[model samples]
Target: MTTTPAPTPDSTVAEWDHVVVGGGSAGALVAARLAARDSGTVLLLEAGPDQPVPRDRAHPLADAGRLVLAGFNWDYRANLRSSGRLEDLLKGGDGTGNPARALWERFPYQLGKVVGGGSAVNGAIALRGLPRDFAAWAEQGNPDWSWDKVLPFYKAIENDVDHPDHPRHGDGGPLPIRRTPRDRVHALDAAFWGECTRQGVTDLPDLNSGEEAGVGPIPGNTVEGERIDAATAFLSDARDLPHLHVRPGVRVTRVLFDPKDRSRAVGVETERDGRLDTVRARHVILAAGAVGTPVVLQRSGVGDAALLGALGIDPVVDLPGVGRDLVDHPSVVIWSRPADGVCTPGLPWRQVAARMSSGFDDDVDVQMGLLNNVESHTIPGFVDRLGWPLVVGMSVMLLRPRSRGRVFLDSADPLASPVIELGLGTDPEDVERLCHGVRRAWGFLRSPGLSARLTRTQFWSDRMVANDGVLRSGVRHIMNPGWHAAGSCRMGPDSDPYAVADQEGRVHGTENLRIADASLFPVIPSAPTNLTTLMLAEKLARSMKE
Candidate 1:
């Protein structure tokens, strides 16, 4: 919350020390950090308006439905050309469905068009990947990006409330971290944990302790019962800072490069209020999430030469990895009615934490989550209160997925939407892994305690008991994406032709320009990416300063 002298507005020209395109999770964090460093003027341009989160929409139960239906958000559609193939395998038919076509025909990928971006609408799950996740970077030839080098950045961005003795978590960082309170613990959750122990899965105490290979209660990026979106965590307080200028309703059309030398990016050309404006900056950072950053680069003529040429775009930088290697976590639901007591409303965050701390049995496959409907008439409510005579039901997600996809330009126009193909479970192993997750969820629901509370629902009743063909179909019916999209613009060593950026997040062969966002991750982390993107922004800001 630092204050400095404001820059004089010009009727003729727009100028800044740094121009950050896209005000999503990554953009907000980078803007706040750069401005906090007292670096010269920084301009943050968002393509959408600043829409406030309504109380009803903010509720965890309500948020899920809203995310799938809301408009002000950038609801980018993902093409599942691969998923259709999987369907053909099961149904013995032709696989030709196009989700991207269907969605773009109506809407777009679900990117948050508002100020906070996806963080404003995400499920507040705060998780970090295993230490080996980072070590893998070194193996790929990025020496400066090993686990040892990036651990400090992770610690600097978090404020953990649960394990005080833990060394990796910070206590006073801008983002707050804590488990759900005890009062909110639902009965279904307790039963689920007990079953997981019986099934030999270990209850992990922390997923963010540089070890994400196990199961645990999902930690959230929430502060005082509200979602701590990136904008609120990084930019809200910093809005008054004179060094930072956040423009909510501006769309960047392209990155402006020096015509004489394409190696250096000068600034950006944007459109606002039906007028075009160019903002000059010594440095330019693109933090426009996965799909956006790549599209921006392509529009700026920085992608595959052939692809660019085909689109009538002259190539500036021929980086083939600009829109490849997309990854995301997919989930499946197993619903059942408890035999007895009313299924509680809200998650039992505290009870789950206590179980984790007590050295509970080690069942390490699926993380069991307890979700309840308190008041809102969302999916949980219909299932728990109205759909049938039931107490509660639960869902478990496969945290780590092996699936990979891509983002590509559908047309050369910057205003035209890009193609995002989420090749979910295309890999046989990924399908098997998610099926295992579904089995684990069923085990927890069918346990002695939980099973005694209610009757099993009929939609998948006969299919649930079967071990072969029907099970796969049942899993496919329920499993969808967690909406954590990333890795389109991967980072790697100079030798990697597919790498969009180097270890410092600078786009390959480009000077005075960088990409500091989820787009920079060579591989998507095991957890929700909001906090990790913020941590990356903090690290990039420090790196730029030095």
Candidate 2:
């Protein structure tokens, strides 16, 4: 890849055919595709500095499970108070029946600030969200986003090593997808799967097949132990293209509008090294992620008219949905000590996960997966918090939570962090289902196969399960982000007042503006959103070319 210095903010206004913001998962791929197709001169801007992907075991990013690393993460925090009624119970207001004191406060929200975005640092699970996920998008008046229509994009974006010849899988795509071999799978994972079978959870070979839901090998995007993120997969070949300019450490402050025709977007205003400058572009695509994208739009005077006006910003578009309907996978973990022979540093971070329906007829709503080792397991200070040198974990996640939250601007400053409120467990059903998942997990842990491989040093006492109220309190204190955020900027027809953009990712109220990111999801998918985000970039890039 070519190394080109970012243009100085004080220099003459740089112009390009398209200016894509945020070089994370989607932006990198979009810019690469446009440039490789020779669409036009494209300028890609990223707020974080670029770093090479390191494969050595000594590096922080070497293990996909090492997600809590400090330097390269956005480190956004969210208010996870599900409701006010549970506040007292969470705070230990009741005299009894609370397992862990409730921490109903702002919790950490992880997003990659690096070039490859989350794909660079996240657990590399390559999941194609259930087909019904797209069907729901189509139901929301986005016909082009239907499962049948979007399946082609999904197929064309992956090079599945295990299922290359399968009709539904792709063999020539840039991103690589593979699973850990059965024989090489960790003992803990094998035991977990054995427990899954006893629980009547089917063992499917491919989780992404969309045929059946059960325990299966995790499909990850990795090559020789190194993550194949968007930057490595999409930008490697397109970086040398004379037309594409990748400008790291340059953050786009807001989208610029035509002075005369305020409804038309012209380009963007950017900030880098404390200097501010404007860049001209024929079109501006907001690939700034769900949180970043909505913040950008709000800063640019394109959110709820009242909210913008209260912040003394002129309203460019009166779309009230810019930062509403925020959704993320809310999860809680049950930690235990691994068997004497387990927790080997050589073992893969994750191997098997159970995807099953909590109650839905056709949809898989929950995910229970094993983390072979906790984040920063190799570090002493970090491991001290969990009180274990090395601990295995089973994360119970609500894949399709009914609760919805938001990311909104508390300050008009472009660089100011937005307020993130994750309304997790706001829906009573959410809490109930999570409690159910925890019970199932407890059963698995107590099963003969898993019991032999895991120690009884548990994060929470097994007796807590008998008390529903106490179990709910435990859910409140321990529930956290699954690191998958979406739906802040939803796509729908104009008839739907909350719709910010159309099916093609075009902003409805403005001209020459578009969005290509997870922010466009109408509903959070029933799986990790990494692969689906890449599929989105591939489809949007092709549409832009056409």
User: What is the TM-score of each predicted model, taking all chains together?
Assistant: 0.85, 0.91
lDDT of candidates 1 onward, in order: 0.68, 0.81
RMSD of 2: 5.5
Clashes of 2: 0
**Candidate 2 lDDT trough over 10 residues, lowest sum:** 92-101
The C-alpha stretches of model 1 lying farther than 4 A from their native spots are 1-5, 8-14, 51-71, 82-108, 181-184, 212-215, 336-368, 374-393, 462-465
Tell me the deviation in Å of residue 507 in model 2. Answer: 0.6
lDDT of 1 by residue, 207-319 (tens): 67775443456677775556677877778778888777778889998898998997899999888877887888788999888888998998999987766776778899899
Superposed by TM-score, candidate 2 places the C-alpha of residue 30 at a distance from the truth, in angstroms, of 0.2
lDDT of 2 by residue, 1-546 (tens): 332333443434346788999999999999999988878778889998776633355566655655534777787876774333223323434312223423443466768988889888888889898888888998999889888888888899899999978888889899899898878777788888877887788988898898547888999997767677888888988778877878889889899999999989999999998899898888899999999999999989898887777667899999999988888888877878776776776457878988876543445668998888553354212234545667777788988898888778766787787777678878887887888888777777787877787775455777897678998899876777777889999999988999999988999889999999999999888888888998898999999988
